[model samples]
Target: MKGHYRKRGANTWAIVVELPADPVTGKRRQKWTSIKGTEKDAQVALRRQLHDLDTGKLSHAEKLTVKRYLEQWLDSKARSSISPRTHARYREICEKHISPAIGKIRLDKLRPLDVQRLVDSLPDKGLSRRTVLHVFRVFHNALERAVRLQLLSVNPASAVEPSKPDQADIAVVDSAGAAKLMDEVVGTRLEVPVALALGAGLRRSEILGLRWGDVDFDDGRATIRQTCQLVKVEEPSAATAKKKTPRFELRFLTTKTHRSRRSVTLPPSVVGLLRRSKASQSERRLLLGAGWQDNDLVVERGDGKPVRPDTLTKQFHKVSDRLGLGVTFHGLRHSHASLLLKGGVSMKAISERLGHVSASFTADVYTHLGRGIEEQAAEAFDRVVKHER
Candidate 1:
């Protein structure tokens, strides 16, 4: 039987407890649990807490240190509400970045200045501004969960100023530069694929995910219904090995966003390039029958497997470096959007082609690129107002 609980403070009270006999020590001991509220409330609270201890609900009540609490937060996160890729990123940041920096620190004792010092020290540690921000974001999210669960009274990360990223001028490759760059790829293995990326505003992953069947020459359009992404895995299981391991398959999966999965009209130049690339692939398949991988459309090798997306960046950089273009593979997509904008394409039309959920997003990213049109608009405004003024 338990004794009567006594009020210790406003919204809190304490209960004297007898520790169970220790066989080795051959003695019982006294202990105490400080619970919050009135006598009846404390009774109910202590009973519920004791129940929780027996049922594993409050398993950590006795040993819920900051590190333990952080682990529980991370574990719950991994089990729900996140994609594998996103979860992996969070896990890496927690383990490699945040935990190493402050894992042993008491969560309740963590001051805003302590966090600020970490952010302040990031630049000296060779962390990129973006990476430091990411580390802070991970901790912020974890601590937010802690606060919600009553493990933390408040989010310490929220009180600290977040690290800011340094801004670089938006890079946009213009029309003439795009044409000159396209000319550089005219003779290489990258010709057709690079053309599609530059001309269609297709992401490199989306291009690699494309298939010959996805194109409609009669309709003069191609459906961007899928995107390829790399995922690391251990050795294949028996079931996976039997079916050619679908991760490696050119298995058509849905696009990343519903807005991105759309039918885009192909230009005559790109349509011809696709025709040529397909015909060339067919000829190569005939040459190597059993040796061909044969799962992807925009394949890089004769083996027919889908092209690795990162290789495109490497190749693009190589070409850009060779040509002194000051552009990137991603710059090709920017070039595509820029040319359309410069040619007086409407934001809605460009958004549709680029698969942006909203034209506002497109407008936001290319504000500098869109400024040229604003300049023209201002010139027209001057013409209209100059005589009146």
Candidate 2:
């Protein structure tokens, strides 16, 4: 038997477990322990030891620390599992939050109370409630992997209560504010970007990643193929740091999700505006001649390089603030959904338009906008009664 227990006294029992043969000596190995409890307790102890031996966790448990294991997990994840931005965020959470808290503890010795203490202490570290929750999730996910790999019998994080962050309000621009925004950007560089955002509801990265070839002027359509990301450049080792390197680099990545890779029909006004933008870009290309760098990007610098996504967000905020709109660039996307919701559009339609994963998620986000729909429903009922009369 792999394990067995025998009663030794009125309240004591002896447990014996068979372990794998010693590698060097090729001799069978066994373990024996005494339990000062009932026969059931001795049986449990015997079974636990057998399971640990089968999983091989007993060998690594004493040597592996939380910080070392997490670093190794991140290195494996960096290969192909997650996007570069997500990997960077995960690493930041590991190094800045998790490691500082419980990283020194042996992985096998980690307990639910230890995890709870880490969660409780994060707010004192000046982290926001949302960020604290994120750290908890990352740590929980790592521990879950450990359980699946037979490194742990259970995930300690599963027993800890997660921090609940207050939901922040979603800001949206009213129709009048959207009109004013369009009017203000008429002759400025913000024209096309603003048009795509307020007019068609593209994310800032998607707007910056748009290429001329992705647009169809005649069909009034644009395909979302890629997105731009500003990723932090990894610090080089001492030898490589001698060479100068930029702090950040812009990269073109695929869409955020399968749903995010979608086609959006442009409003006619946006199409017309884009036509003008194309003409203007052509003139600039001619002026630069051979010096022009043609990256085929629809929105770019005069020399034909992609616009940094943050620069677009800052410029958009500047205009919105000047106009007293109080709306951020992303707020414009919320405004787009608000405007559509007010026009009797269904939540499912808006979800598909915005490339959200599900209509229910879209409805939850724009639930505040449902008052207008309720009002419209009441008006429709009154009209039916009047027609019957």
Candidate 3:
């Protein structure tokens, strides 16, 4: 019920608290927690411990290892809160990066230096700065939950500074280059997807998740409401003796952001292409009769099953390489934005078409493509001034 602090050593204090009697032993119980700061800090620690005891929020035991604690944190707190893709990514980082380095260390005994060392060693392990930063964030978030639970006084990972990721160069092809790539993919299954990417600026997942119901051929627009992605599945261990399933499971999820679910007006050419593609699919469905999957997906295999995003990327890469375009599938999206910028379209319009969160974000991403427009603006200003004078 009451707690007090006593100096254990120079700058060290121990907080001792009395608890209710043990039911089995019929004897009083006590809890002692050591603090390593000033007198004020020791008093604060005592108050926190007494409050935890009063509220029954005290941690079970200090014997929990970092690995075990992280696992528990993910299952109990993270799994339901985060997106499935993010939860899986966090688990992968913890298992592959953090577990091997400091998993055996007790959670209460983890130090800032220990976390820093783990972060510092990531570069030597061939991880990029971005990946290292992601790993640190995941570990830091897990440790933060521990602090909130009163399992540790502070998050050790917070004291560690991971390397910052470098700004990646945005690669995009010009209209002519995009046309050349499209020419190469013409008459192929990738034609419609390439058209959608270059014309509507759809992400690969959005393109794959496109359904017939989402397209408005009459209005020349497409609504982006969902995205398809392949989530990696953890294989069962031998002890579980479960039957093996596919390594990855395909799932349809909400768009990357609420703003990402906006509608994009398709180009006339893209609309025409999609119309033809839809007619062909209808004919194939009738030919296959009851054997058809009838998923109504816009981009799918010969059957109605959705095409994997990876498969689309690979095919795009192969065609780009064959044409010497050197443009990624995402490059088509960049090209779409670049062409719109070059055509003097407003950033707000382009941003809305691309389903970007904001016009400023669209402008920032396409700033490099705006240099010519800046020059044109300067020339036009000079001409108007000279004519008026």
Candidate 4:
């Protein structure tokens, strides 16, 4: 419905019409085409474009730059459909990886070779295979949307195969190592959070999001219904030239996946630890009196404010370095899973306990831990045959 005519050369005129805003970039979209002759010809062309736009036929005339189209596509289509974190990640990928490479190419003229060249160049730029795969996925998904929108005849990204990432090596601590680490952290602020990660296999975000209400002391269980994490916010355009650092704010979001919202039975040791943590918090609240923020979070700062996930990670790293533990905070969760697997826990049970989408995924991730189980199974089979003989 938005159209206009402007003088071009002596006898030529240009017709311009505003289209839907780019979904990715959140920028305005405009289509411009030239017509030879007088003002009458320009007005006629403008009317036709307006009519086409109104009837959804203007897609045929789209001559958008790849950068422009990606911006528009992400803003209009992807913003509402995806999580804020995922949307931000897609935007980062587009800006950092895709835009610098082939963004100026005409959307209609983009070729598979162009995409392949970009993918081939990523490794030379020092990106890992996993990160390169993520970049490819974002680009591929955007192109798929473009095809659906009739912006492209075919998705060029579909012709370029993304490289598969190598299997990740997981580091886990033994029972003795975990016990020593726990003893070192005794009576420290990290005690409860570390216990949750090592004993209950809770993710860092899940531990931060836990509240007193989520814990059932009588039932000896805890429910993971939400997660808290700090997400980076885009800086204002006016502040960009000042080199202002990006800001991050704590946000409480739904569990990572549908299966992530599950219940975990608490071990008696963890229960006792939680009880002691609660008593310590109660003493602090009494001392602070009216100054206390009372957020009821199981893991929080002294003022009851949410603990920043990054801060927790840094502190854990410092403690691990001092103790020479040689394990990350996530290693605690890996240790918990490894211990459970070694104790003969069923794969399905472990998957559910870890809130995995499927037991197969759990088994795949813990394949190294399952080797001992194979030996145990073989031993049991031998015993059965010997008894029968």
**Candidate maximizing TM-score:** 2
- A best-first ranking of the candidates according to their lDDT comes to 4, 2, 3, 1
Q: Candidate 2's residue-wise lDDT over 1-389, tens digit each?
A: 37788888989888877654532234676667788987777778887877776766553344468998898778777886466889889998999999988999989899999999999999999999989999999999988887776667788999998767775678888888888889999988889988898889899888888999999988899999888889877666566876745478888888878889899999999999999999999999999999888888888977898899888888888888898888899988888998999888889989988989999989878776887678888999999999999
Question: Model 2: how large is the Cα RMSD against the reference?
Answer: 5.8
Tens-digit per-residue lDDT, 1-389, candidate 1: 24446787787888754333321233554446787667788788777756543443432222345565567677787677444456657777777766677667766566677677777777787989988888888877887776665445566777787657764465656767778777888867788767887899888777878877788999888889777666543356787675533243223445757789898898898898888878888888988899888676764556687777777678888888887888778778878898898788998899989999899989877777788888988898999999889
Each prediction's Cα RMSD?
8.4, 5.8, 6.4, 5.9
- The order of the candidates by TM-score, greatest first, is 2, 4, 3, 1
Note the residue pairs that clash in candidate 2.
Answer: none
TM-score of 3: 0.76
Which regions of candidate 2 deviate over 4 angstroms? 1-48, 52-62, 237-246, 375-389
- Model-by-model lDDT, in order? 0.72, 0.84, 0.84, 0.85
| lDDT comparison, 2 vs 3, better candidate | 2
Backbone clash pairs in model 2 (N, Cα, C under 3 Å; residues 3+ apart or in different chains), count? 0
State residue 133's C-alpha deviation in candidate 4, in Å.
Answer: 1.3
Query: What CA RMSD would candidate 4 show?
Result: 5.9
Model 4: residues with Cα > 4 Å off, grouped in runs: 1-61, 76-78, 81-83, 150-154, 237-245, 379-389
Give one digit per residue, the lDDT tens place, for model 3 in 291-368: 888777999998899898889999889988888888899989988988888888999999988889898988777776
**Each prediction's number of clashing residue pairs:** 3, 0, 0, 12
lDDT of 1: 0.72
Which candidate gets the maximum lDDT versus the true structure? 4
